[model samples]
Target: MPNQRYTNQRNTEAPMQSSIENLSRAIFTVNRHAKTAPDPKFLYTLKRQALEKLLAEGKATKKGLHFSKNPKNSRQQSDVLVSAGEYFFHLPPTKEDFSELPHLGELNDHYRNPKANMSLSVAKTLLQQYANYYPTEDKKQPGKKTYQKPIFKRLGESY
Candidate 1:
């Protein structure tokens, strides 16, 4: 019975060693595949060395990796304020991000001469939408349609 117990222990030890060897080979294969560059250096070896150095420095403990926390941006400045009355919108200067609408006829320019160029009909539509949704704080509630003149009218047009 003692001899049988000794044989059983040997049998279990052989399989355990083979299992460990298989696990190590699998780890090496994964480490090789994780390499992004075609360089001869193994990332696993580099990571192991770095971890050993950190451990020696007492910075890394059994709990987890530790490092100094970075300071937050407390003095971050706000963007430029551009408003139309109480409400305003942000439009990026990049042209490619937005699609250009087809040309609508020129509208009457009260400040300038008789008429001025109107290339952006979408802007007019957006402004109209905003005006419709948010007329004013005291005047009208949001989502109520309001009668407003088109952004562009004919040279002698009246609406």
Candidate 2:
């Protein structure tokens, strides 16, 4: 007879695997768009938050650090490497990361994230839900004035 416990475990594993796969694909899509996006703040934030949540849940693991390819101001820098499912990502390193994770030196140019077929909208939605992020609109108050025309007076004229 088939073991009941084994069957139940197998059933549970399937869903977990699919969810992880979906999350990885969503992350890939978000990252790809963020690179060329005019305003990528929200996209990047979603990716970071989702990865952090996955790390906290043990669904992702930190591999180490890698030298940033495009360091700002031409200064040497590094990023924390994280692995989720079959994909890898980089996050800004913390102080503790310097002492904890080993430095992996330069990033490998030959390696690339797996191709993801998900649409940008779908990926954004999935990440927004997973990361529990709701973007706040920067709407101006109806009664608030953003600018005012300066009053001009000729010569030394005064009221």
Candidate 3:
């Protein structure tokens, strides 16, 4: 009779144990499969609009510079002006180039943290560097300002 009562108790607990296991599995699955929400700080659309507006104003013709794409890296979103038929310039230097401009700490920091604002002078300096390095056809030599690496295609492919 005692064994029969123990068996009855065990049978009664089976459903509760099963329910607890199911609940644990559901929670584990939810947590394991959960996705992280994307950060909204990056201006995905504004960058393009800003570029278009800047180009439409003919800033390239007057300032002697324009935004294109970095030849060294074709997949970059921000455009660096084309010069001597090469995209040697990057608006905010890529991770590889960031270390080179240690003096421009504020600008580099701003690049790393997009939310942070950068000084106008630093921004101008970057643009000026590109302008000085890659002048227009009238000002630059045909062979000057070549890409460090062998570019597979002709320049202006992305711009």
Candidate 4:
């Protein structure tokens, strides 16, 4: 049988060895995470490293690479959390050791800068959506089908 590797080291390392750890420490004002309280950096680093391998879709875990009814392995496991827009992901009992993983949308703002992403057409469409949601009586009912105006209109106009 193959030898089972085991110890305080195996596919994992000290927190100081990872950029994620360093990043975590910086993101959180705690100064020291594992030794301190819960920090947002703990979330970022955990997700930054485990995002690819930690997805379970319908379930949550306090362990890395965890699922079903399997046993826990703290030596190579750590809890983590991730947030994408309104969505939230979590990994309890977080640890740090990231050598593989890439940030999502890291360069999305490059070609599509803040100003570039905001096009006149898109602005018009968004405005129209909210505009239609307003409650108003038709000034001149064309044929009883009825149309409405923005009775409570937004105070400002976009260019």
TM-score of each: 0.17, 0.77, 0.19, 0.14
Model 1: weakest 10-residue lDDT segment is 80-89
RMSD of 4: 25.1
Runs of candidate 2 exceeding 4 Å displacement = 1-18, 139-159
**lDDT score, candidate 3, position 29:** 28
Rank by TM-score, descending?
A: 2, 3, 1, 4
**Per-residue lDDT tens digits of candidate 4, residues 1-159?**
479776663332322222332222222222123234353443334333433332333122222222212236634332333432222333343234132322231112233111122232332233223223222354555666656765664679553
RMSD (CA, Å), each prediction:
32.6, 10.5, 26.3, 25.1
Off by over 4 Å in 3: 1-37, 40-42, 60-79, 82-159
Local distance difference test, candidate 4: 0.32
Q: What are the per-model numbers of colliding residue pairs?
A: 1, 0, 1, 5
The TM-score between candidate 3 and the true structure equals: 0.19
- Model 2 TM-score is 0.77
Query: 2 or 4, which is superior by lDDT?
Result: 2
Q: Write the per-residue lDDT of candidate 1 for residues 5-53, one digit (tens) a residue.
A: 5334333223222222232233233234435546424334433333333
Cα displacement (Å) at residue 113, model 2 = 1.3
Decreasing lDDT order of the candidates? 2, 4, 1, 3
Model-by-model lDDT, in order?
A: 0.30, 0.88, 0.29, 0.32
The residue-level lDDT of candidate 4 at 123 comes to 27
